[model samples]
Target: MKSFDVAIIGSGPSGASAAFELSKSGISTVIIEKETLPRYKTCGGGLVFRGLKMMPFDISSVVEKEFYAIDTYFSQKHPCITTRRKEPIVSMVMRDAFDNLIVEKARNNGVTLLQNHKVVDITFGETQTIHTTEGDVTAKFIIAADGALSPIAKIAGWKETRTIIPALEYEVEVPAADFERLSNDARFDIDAIPYGYGWCFPKKNHLSIGVAVVIKTNKKINLKEYYAAYLKRLGITEILKEEGHGFVIPVAPRTDFFVQKNVFLTGDSAGLADPLVAEGISNSILSGIQAAEAIIESQLDPEKAAVLYTEKLKTGILPEIEKAKVLSYHFYSKKSFRNIILMKYGQYAAEALTDLFMGERTYPKDYLKSITKKIKDAIFF
Candidate 1:
């Protein structure tokens, strides 16, 4: 059995980031990827400037476009709010190229990548056993960065609690003229789907369009139909491929468990994606870094590593997620509350959200307290 200091499942941003940090520290690491490298990843391909700033190395070659403003729309078309800043807010890149670039960097840092290796099963004991199509490999530590419906988490019985929601994305290769004509800088259409949002993110040559539905709302949704309606709203009559891909995204951080015995959950496995924007790549990279840091700090003690991970996670990603959950709750659950507030202060909220995306502002711990204070001081006073 092949053994290593650490084994990472899934070679996306989280796993690759972990490998990069661990290998840089001289800890042997292996990344097990089910598919060959550079395969198409189902994402809107919108990376906020914060994620771009967090990367240790440059990925300029993979960046397709950068936007200084993001246009956000309400259920109606006319009263849209545009979040603008002097610096670029979001950078767009195809996930295949972007993820491959990160993997290459991790490889350069001495991480071994086992491509086309599907993990069939995993067994936990003194050392963790990863059963793959290639062979069984053992590692002292396992980083389950394996996406929303993580098989590793299922095998390990980490937690049944997660705010897993359905999202669909389509990379439509429109004609060059239509692509140019229809592509906006960055746009998010709220209420594109009930209790969720639709987005139109421009790539270099194509446009990535998608809709997400919040599952906790208990609303039965047809994502494909919503996507078609969105295309119509955008006046997209011609498309090279109407094919769409569906995947699950975690909106809230897992409050249940981050570790089971020797396994550490990062990324979607840990449910660490941002609750507000549903952005995983940024926090996924952050979780990967903290996971490696915890392992290194704990001196490989599973219990101590678990403690360190939880503590760091609280200080790391949970606060933002909590605030986002507040936003989600108000926006989706309480119904008309979101509309009332957005109607009154949509521009301010849009600007704040843009700054939040750019890492300029952090969401207050108690969103209602802070925001209400601001509203009262400004309006009532």
Candidate 2:
């Protein structure tokens, strides 16, 4: 049996990031992955600037493309809102290459990688004995960095508390003309679906186009219908090749404890994706860093690590997620109100969102009140 101080499940950004930080701190760490390296992960693959800024090492080799300007379209009545920055607002990457780079970096720092090992069960006590298809591995601490449908979280006794939203993405290779026309910038089209949005991210040779329903609904949403409409809207024709992938995004955090019995939940397992944009990469990486740091600061004491991790989240990532949740409610639920706010302050809102994506500013604490006061002042003046 292999043994380590920490064992991380899933080689996604979250797990690999935790291993990177833990190994760098001289802690014994092992990464357990179900799939082989360079495996395809279903994501829109658009890394916002905030996520890019969090990387400890250069990722130029994996970066497919970068965009300094982004456009957000509402409808014909409202003009498209564009935001520009000197630095790239978003960088494109295929997850297979991107994730493998992080795992390789961690391996260089003495982290063990056990690929093709799917965890089936975990026995918890002073330490955890993880049962995988290949063999058994034990660790003093376990970090669940698996994706939204985290079996580890379920095995650890967590009930469903997150708001999981549906999204469909396509890796499309259009004809030369179509690719040229759509490849210059990334864009978001609000109202492309009933209560959701559509995005187009240009990559090195293809386009990662996706549409997501950001809110929960009782009625059925035909995402395929919406995606077809979106493609027509974008003037795409004569596709040389295309592939479709469907996935869910957990926009809300778990209401229960983040740490249970020495097992730590990070990334999608903890439901830490951004509420407004449904961006998971930035928060996932951030939470993994915090988890590793918490364990390191606690000197591997499970109790202290749990308390410290919760405290760090409350002070840092959790608060920002709370603020973004409020903004998301208004942005999606209140259509008329949102339209009014956007019509009057569209440019300002776009710039502010850009700042948030760039890691330059956080969501305002009093976001609702702040916007209300601005609208009131505008009306009076």
Candidate 3:
């Protein structure tokens, strides 16, 4: 058995981020990836500025587009609102390239990279054994960053604790006219699908367009139908692909995503996507960092490590997720999202959201203070 200080499963944002940080900290870590590096990954491919700010190194080579404004629609084009900022709030990149950037960085930092390795089973104890097709690896700590529907998390008996929702996306090729026309702006349309939303993220040559919905939330509406309608709304008739790729995304961050037990869950495996936007890359990266910190601080004491990791989670990501949960139903209900969140505060809210994308503000960090002051001002002024 090959023994290491730490073992990470899956090489997406979370796993790669953890490996990168651990190596930088001089911790011995190895990442066991199920597939080869630079593989294609299904995503909206929008790297929010907040996510970008978390990167220690520059990825300008992978960035396809940087937009200064985000255009949102309630329905079709009616009541369309545009939020503009002084700087680009979101940058676009293909997942294959984006993930490769982080993974390569970790490799360069002295982290061992094992590709084409699928984890079949994991034996947990003081020393964890990860049995893979390639071989078995033993480590004092394990980080499960495999993604939603994570095999590692399920084998670890975490299947029932996390709830996953369905998400679908596409790399659509349209006519030159349409591609050029739509490429100028990025669009986020709410109610594009029942209990969900749709987006159009323009790339170098095509627009990655799709719709997503919370699983089991709306039984009557079909996501495919919504996706077709969304394309029609955008006048993208020349779809190069017949059927888009479909996957499950966790809608809310799991309260127990960080359950210690000498194993930690990061990224979608931990259900860390935003409840409102379903944006996850940023939080997952941050969780990866926090998990590394906890592991170093506890230094192989499983019981103590679990407690400290849980505490770190509660303060770091859990609070943001909790606040988002409260805001979810209300924000998505009866168009209250527009009335309460966007309208009540108006440009101020827009700026705040822009700040959110810029990593200037994080959920629940300044969430309570901002809301309390807004309420006071609404009543008295």
User: Which has the greatest TM-score?
Assistant: 2
Candidate 2 lDDT over residue span 185-230, tens digit each: 9999988887789999999999999899987778798999999999
Error of 2 at 192 (Å): 0.9
**lDDT, model 2:** 0.92
Report the error of model 3 at residue 151, Å: 1.0
Model 1 CA deviation exceeding 4 Å by range: 370-381
User: Which digits, one per residue and each the tens of the lDDT, describe model 1 over residues 255-351?
Assistant: 7778886888999888887876788889888899899999888877888988998899888688778778877777766656566666667888888
Please, what are the lDDT tens digits per residue for candidate 3 over residues 267-306? 8888888776788888888888877777878876677777
lDDT (0 to 1) per candidate: 0.85, 0.92, 0.80
List TM-score per model, in order: 0.95, 0.98, 0.91
Please name the candidate that would achieve the greatest lDDT relative to the true structure.
Answer: 2
**TM-score-superior candidate, 1 or 3:** 1
Decoy 1 TM-score against native: 0.95
Q: Model 2 segments beyond 4 Å from truth?
A: 377-381
Superposed model 3: Cα runs more than 4 Å off: 76-78, 214-218, 241-243, 336-348, 364-381
